[model samples]
Target: MAVVDHAPGSGHRTAGDPGGPGPRGLGRIGAVPPRRRIDPADGLAAVTAWRTASDGSPPPRPVLATAVRWTLAELADRYPGGACEVRVPPFGVVQCIPGPRHTRGTPPNVVETDADTWLALATGRTTWADAVATGRVSASGERADLSGLLPLE
Candidate 1:
């Protein structure tokens, strides 16, 4: 199964795993605030009402989820690397960073974090090293240092 950063109400790991790469090998940025559970229905309703009043048009179907999926896909494609891969639900793996290709089981490098954290990093709100140091991200491999190619913003 594809790795997912967010899973309903289950909180993610807050500390980076030691068995993998070292902490903040890149540089310190900031930590992402933990997210609270949001009722899908309630969120959908709020978005729908806001859209209708704001644009006088019907709300898009599951627009939030769709947007998240799109965001994941865009990032995955933007940072393609044969050694590493970004995982988010609804959007699959994307080859980023042109390099020696890997066609085996485990990739040489990999960085996995939650959807919120990923979004924050993508939007220039967070840093890869900071997230990894705070245990918000789990990364491995030599070239897995994604500090340079982040916050696609």
Candidate 2:
């Protein structure tokens, strides 16, 4: 599953892009979020809201953002390092895995995905292979694969 980089606002849409199955997201701009510590409790609450919204609608942006950041933070703690960069855009980004840390330019290993896909994968609702196969995730460079470390239970 190789996804090439596209310019910002390139209008590139994956099979089940940011909005996922339904009209989940109106539209979104992908960007790195500021670094912050998100309590796992807050994160879990937001994720729960996203998963059990009943209306089949996504949680509010900030709430969803919290979920994204919390999972990313958890991942970082699990595999502490600067080897890989995981991006769930317009929400959060985190450096993770154990490998050579990039001191300049972009990190070699990078994983990028929409908030919906990220939420699904992060919480075990979806698997890494499935997301890649469906083009719901973009991964590049060595060490980018996060198949072994996911579904943050």
Candidate 3:
């Protein structure tokens, strides 16, 4: 799972766990803890917003961030256990699939792409083979191909 820094002094948030606590025990204080994972429903909302943008204009950073994070998190949530690491730079990374777990050094299975490509693939805007053929994605290891599980839309 991807690990990200949440609010200051708050505990780290793993990609698959959205209900984790926030800074200084905020959840214990009855405050809503910061979201660590993307809720599938919320992800759908983000996707809708993006798809409805006028003239193909890109949504704001927050919207894109939400969509990207949610999709990636949802992927992690669906595929429990760590066998492959998927990376969307400047947005998030998630460990998924089910097989031998990688602990250190270069992971055996890895998939990487820019945020746009990842979003496109996740939303069915592009195919895994097209992304790979066009050099928009870099995948390594036997289990790194996610064509079967893509278009999470």
Best-matching candidate per lDDT: 2
For candidate 2, write residues 49-152 as lDDT tens digits. Answer: 88886248777888888888888889999999999999988988888988899867878999999988998898888999999999999999889999999888
State model 3's lDDT.
Answer: 0.82
lDDT (Cα, 0-100) at 77 in candidate 2: 92
Model 1: how far residue 14 lies from native, Å: 51
Where in model 3 is the C-alpha error above 4 Å?
1-35
Q: Write the per-residue lDDT of candidate 3 for residues 30-109, one digit (tens) a residue.
A: 55545586676888888778777623888887888888899898888778667899999888888999999997788999
Q: Tell me model 2's lDDT, rounded to 2 decimals.
A: 0.83
Which should have the higher lDDT, number 1 or number 3? 3
Pairs with steric clashes in candidate 3: 18-37
lDDT measured at residue 49 in model 3 versus the true structure, 0 to 100: 81
Candidate 1 lDDT tens digits, 19-50: 21235322234433343344546644544443
Q: Which stretches of candidate 2 lie over 4 Å from their true place?
A: 1-35
Q: lDDT of model 2 at residue 88? A: 89
Best by TM-score: 2
Per-candidate TM-score against the hidden true structure: 0.52, 0.74, 0.72
RMSD (Å) of each candidate, 1 decimal:
16.5, 15.2, 9.3
